[model samples]
Target chain A: MTELATTLEALAVHKQFCEDVLNMPGGEKIKICQQCGTCTGSCPTSYLMDWGPREIIAAFRAGMIDRVVKSNTIWLCTSCYSCTVRCPAGIKITDLMYELKRLAIKYDLAPKDGKAPAMTKYFIDSVHKHGRNHEVELMAKFMLTKDWGLPFKFAGTGLKLFTAGRLPLFAKNIRGRDELDKISAYLEAQEAKAQ
Target chain B: MRYLYYPGCSAEATGKAYDISTRALMGKLGVELVELDDWNCCGATSYFSVRELDSFAIAARNLAIAEKQGDEDLCVICNACYTTLAKTNRYMAESAEVREAVSGALGAVDRTYSGNKPVRHIMDVLVNDIGLEALGEKVTRRLTGLKVACYYGCQYSRPMGDFDDPEFPVTMDKFFQALGAEVITDFAGKAKCCGGMMMLTKEEGALRMCHELLKGAHDAGADVIVCACPLCEMNVEGYQPRVNKTFGTNFDMPVMYFTQLAGLAFGADPKQLAIDKQIVSCDRVVAAIPA
Candidate 1:
């Protein structure tokens, strides 16, 4: 009887996972995925991903959300929308990838080896700080914290861009930068109230 | 015609040439571009990966400002910005929950968005609004024999095929053809992803993608590859050495923003187009165009 109760509880968690995905904007179309390999076929980075978009959808349907989130699949997505455009079932696969990325970040399920999450964090942090993303600052911060060898790899192109005046050292802040904070605070309050 | 321009974050940095040339080209075409006042970042794809509602809210802020400040459509040059802003407008119109959340966020900032502002790509405005026939007539220097590859890149017409075919966009090609450049219609990597910001995160995947794109242009014997997106321009042009190093292939293809090439075809001096800023010098192609 106890084993039955635990099994039901686990099933409920899996059911909630599907519900969460379905609740995302345009996420309801996951039900009609058709198991076609078009998305995986269309993906440019799927070769590098552990599981392609088709397999991710299949795994999610099978209640392997834990594995799906932990895998490098979602992080590998470039958000190019190639899969979304080609999906015969009309699934927004790229947006679904973004949602999965949010889920991974929210639950601390992203893989440790993945740099995309950290890169995204730094990008958003740059926007929050300067009201714009400073490419040089973003790259410097990303390299110092995430990939130390990046500076060496980027040295050549960096020199060329710098000489051409494309790599600006300073980011120009927008006048109404404080509005971002107010917007975020209001949304946070609304989310807190909803919870 | 007049439009409110959103030069995106890249316009101030890596894509400065695109912005400079776009303005020069538009001025030559007799179009007016009013820069959006105090516009913040669009939150981009990175923000979308972190917080969905926050991403929509921040992107909507730009639209709200555009609505409050202007009656003309918001003209975006970067494909990522174009898609992000347009996508926010789309989700707001389609989902009431999204509409409510975005509106509430805007309300907090003492602004409002009616979700009716049209977000247009520069290519769409160039091709559809200003017909190719008119554009052809304005070309003071026709690129008669210049072989060009019009690299549309991802997000130019994807996830929202409002302007052109998502998988196979031809607006850039058509635009180039109108300028008398021989467009490479069969370029395989025209709409492929350039790995975008992945160049910073996962260099290998991005390098491989750039290799394929460069190889396609090289194989087509393209004198120059024109880009519509800032990231795509940076990747295919700036990362050629990286791509060549990884793939063990020699690729020196000159990648220019479509506006730069258009500016060139319009008799604007090479300096006006910031042609010298290109990593791979376009001197050869510039010489090829029949002046």
Candidate 2:
């Protein structure tokens, strides 16, 4: 809407994000958001959240990282990155969203809805346990994590695929878990120091 | 150009089509794919979600394997694997802080990733390096009149610039156009999540994503949806029925790896394209392409 500081915060896509993350090849380009409202207009879930891409960029420029983190907007981002390509300014809204998510977790702002980030956690844990994802185990563990009754919800879907030979129920779990753990431990240790 | 092609976990599993078609096409395009001697998973959606460092290290190890294999340049066929590996590779190569930490953690395993490798999604390789003009000449079968939409799933494109113009990416379109197919220009559910890795934890979201992509393609009058990643293929193909039932949207759309379609253009048989493997029958697209 109105100019917050007359600067193209919405236009400044790359600068709106963390400097470290924005420095990557496609990273720096998000800084040119001219805020034409094209992205918000095209976003299917824009109305579902309090703010759209324009506001998200502005908030970041206004030094509103925490506000952006604590809001449901970050979680709601289907991560379409529609704004990135759609923006005449060529902003990388999706990259900004990822950097925000990392920052949220780093600051312990991860939603405690007791589980939302569980998907993220399950994935990382799977990798740490094995160098590769054990699709079957990851699926089982994920359902268990959602709620004990959650598995029942997917039973019908699972059964349909079972008959088709698609859901083999026994996805081959990749081996070499010890090495995965070692690597995981190393990255975890580094992350801890960054905090 | 030489690259250590890492198909990630899905390349060997459900999305094997991506692996097979890519290897075949690479040879046609004059590139060599050296399978990592003992590469592992790159720890996609779930790994990065759980613990940052561990996921990075897990991803880092894969990068190390590729580097040791001696190709500073790499190509990832799966969208999710491409993103996760690129993230780790860049971190290992650029951040001494991350590299040393990952090295220390991986010390017990006797592995370390130098991260000098540049990971290019297969789409970049074909459209950028190989060039559409080259492919246009190589096309033995022009997919005339067959309408298609390029479904650049979240992993294959985003945080990595999401390829093309993130919003209006032209990667898939250019590739299809190279094959002489009608590339539909409609705003679709793609450029969004495929509800990958969420197949378990948050299926509602995943299903929503699936319905959107499939229905979007169908509604846009597309005959097929082309994809670049294994997880996207599995989710799009494997979850189509669930999405239909959950949303009551009736439409059969076959998702294909870009190479699969390219293989068809290059005169590979339907079997070579892995058409029958999809949840939806590929007879529709197969009937359109020549024998």
Candidate 3:
């Protein structure tokens, strides 16, 4: 009886993995994925992903969380909703990908030199500091911290937009930032509990 | 109809033309767009990827302010803002735990979100509130010779699926026809993804995807491709030159926002519309339009 119980406990990997993803807001739909390759077929950027939409779900179902988190699939998702719209099982595949992205960043599993994670960090940092996104500041910081050489690569287009007065130099903050801070803090506490 | 307009951060920068033309067209159509004061960022695609509940909280703060303003409808121009704000609003209303947590957050700022008001995109209000026939009557200049390819860019009708067919949307095509342009109904790039946020990370993939879109529009013989999303505009237009160089294809497709074309049809000054600010020159579109 003790040997049987231990064997049954060892078989709970799939259930354990499923629960991890389902804990996200829109991630419950992954349970209904059906192993269909429709999502992979429908994805525009699937050709570029290490694991397409279908494989991401498959890997997650098989308790390969580490592999899925470290893969480029989650970061490459354009959030176009094509797979979500096309899924016959009504699975919100794109939203589930977003959940994986959040997990990857939280766990520091994201690639060190990955531009996607770098851009995401810079973007969120921009919003966290200023009430609004200061495009100039975000780009400046991203290039400075992430890849100092990226500035020269984008100089031509940057100069054109600057000359056109489309890229504003000054940062604009919303009026009620104190309220935003309160809300951010409240939600952060809730996120800590979930983690 | 009075709406609490949220132009978002991009509307003032990369989408400056969209902002100008949207305001002009709204004013001309007699639609009242009251700016939502002290409104913050919707956090775009980045914030949520970092923290889930915190992303909701930040966006909810904006919705909370809109809710406080007498329950008027919240109108957004940029697709990212529309999707994020509406998603946050719907999520808060649907999930009990989400509502409680967001409510707790708002309470700190002395606010509440009952989810009474509807969050709408510019296209929704343009087609639904101000009907197509009414909009057709206000067109002072007909874009008869212009061949337009309407590009919805994946976010407008998908996921939410509120307004039109997600697979093949014709709302924008219909609107362009109502404005007297020859709308290309068969363009394959209409509902295709522009690989928006991926542009910064996966440049090669994004460029390849954008090149496909440009080729489709070019092959469809479109004079211009109009999009509703700012990121779509940034991707298709900003990356056109690189795509051309990479593919050895000189596809100089002028990607314009639907609002800019609507502004043209409404006979507003092209300068007022900031038509020239577009990365891809709209000179061909301007030449085709009857002055």
Candidate 4:
């Protein structure tokens, strides 16, 4: 590949990042981040993140879309909204994290080590099938496919909850479960038209 | 007063006690709750992480039903559902693109949402609409000596602090006080995150967060911790042993849904309130409440 073509391709990713963030609700506020660390400070799990909220903003400004998408920071977010409420710039940091997560999944850039994406996929699948999330089914699928040791670790609590009748064995399918599929189909067509 | 209730998916399973107690408590308060017919999942945080438009559409489906089914405001028990549905409303009102996409999706499903329905938290309805004075009068057995750490968790008032302070909510505290329970107003972890779904995806981070919340309630000398969200209740109560195992600390705390405790105060039977469903026995806290 020629150097100029490679440069333009890199620039396209940066441009796409900006456009994606700008399209989100309250996404424009990302440009006003003061390089302040309040978001990271307020983040309960920032210590475990590969890139804290503050650093993510800085990276966004630096046009390092590749780096941001490849990091574990977005997946680690618990959607607590602490950073969004605490940011002095009025930036919706949590929303920004969600956008990044979507981008990572779209480009197939999500780290293999991140279990959040898998959990999210299984969760959505459950919703698609039953119109509501079946807790026992979702947990069982995730534990079996993702973490084999979870059943053993959760056995005591699981048995107790089961005895209490809190853990039901069957999922209740809503009457209008097909309505969800229709909604998805419509949205997919809209996206295709946009593209 | 009547309202449409959206019991998020958890209420059917892990949070059934919350559903039972809420119904009993509201019934005693003379507030009629009509469950929203054919409600689906709000997609929670999981949906938005992958597809934003789909999340808004699914969440708005319930709102659309609420608009079609009744004139009453929608009352939501789960914080995540409240936030997701409220968020769809906010985004629809703010962004023309979101409005267009969501309306198109809803139209395909033969439903429509005008974005005018109010999505409310139960605590908000109890404290604001029902009035604390009225709630106080309904209490037959006052929780005179109970020390309650009201854990708001995240999403209770965040990103849209319409009803309470996003950072430090006092609605639960004030609600408990009205029932004559001793409210721990200074609990540091009252509005902190309890790991939510991360408890399954990332155990270490979630366990650490739960540890802090449990420790805060313990330090406040709380006899019981009352939660506003099911995920918070599960993480703090269901995983207390896991938290202790990870943190190497001995902590035994009874975490109940705020409605469960409120039901007891409203003179509802313990069985009716589903108090037996709690993992950590609330028998101590129950005995402490004056008969």
Q: What lDDT score belongs to each candidate, Candidate 1 first?
A: 0.90, 0.68, 0.82, 0.91
Residue-by-residue lDDT tens digits, candidate 1, B38-102 = 89999989999988999999999999989988899999999999999999999999999899999
Candidate 1, residues A1-195, lDDT tens digits: the string is: 012114676566556657878889989899988998999998999999889999999988877777688778998899899899888888999989998898777656676656899899989888988888888899888888889997788789889999999999998988888888888889889978985
> Where does model 2 exceed 4 Å of error?
A1-115, A145-176, A187-195, B27-31, B89-109, B186-190, B202-206
How far residue A172's Cα lies from its native spot in candidate 4, in Å, is 0.7
Candidate 2 local distance difference test against the native: 0.68
DockQ of 3: 0.64
RMSD of each: 2.7, 6.9, 3.9, 2.0
Listed models, DockQ each: 0.79, 0.25, 0.64, 0.85
- The parts of candidate 4 lying over 4 Å away from their true place are A1-14
Per-residue lDDT over A47-84 for candidate 4, one digit per residue giving the tens place of the 0 to 100 score: 99888989989987887777688778998999999999
- lDDT string for model 3 (B1-291, tens) is 789999988887887888888898888788888888788899887887877677787888788778777567898988888888888877887788778887888887888777656889899899888989999999999999799999898878877877888899888988989999999899998989888877767778988889989999999899999989888998898878778878999987888999988988887877888888887789889878987
Which model is ahead, 1 or 3, in terms of TM-score?
Answer: 1
- Models 1 onward score TM values of 0.96, 0.76, 0.94, 0.97
Q: Report the C-alpha lDDT of model 3 over A1-195, residue by residue, as the tens digit.
A: 011113555345434445757876666777777987999999999998898989988888776776687788998888888998889888878778877887666545678888888998888777767888888887787777777765675667677778777898888877786666677777777757865
Winner by lDDT between candidate 4 and candidate 1: 4
Q: Of the pair 2 and 3, which is ahead by TM-score?
A: 3
RMSD of 3: 3.9
- Clashing residue pairs found in predicted model 3: none
CAPRI tier for the interface of model 4: high
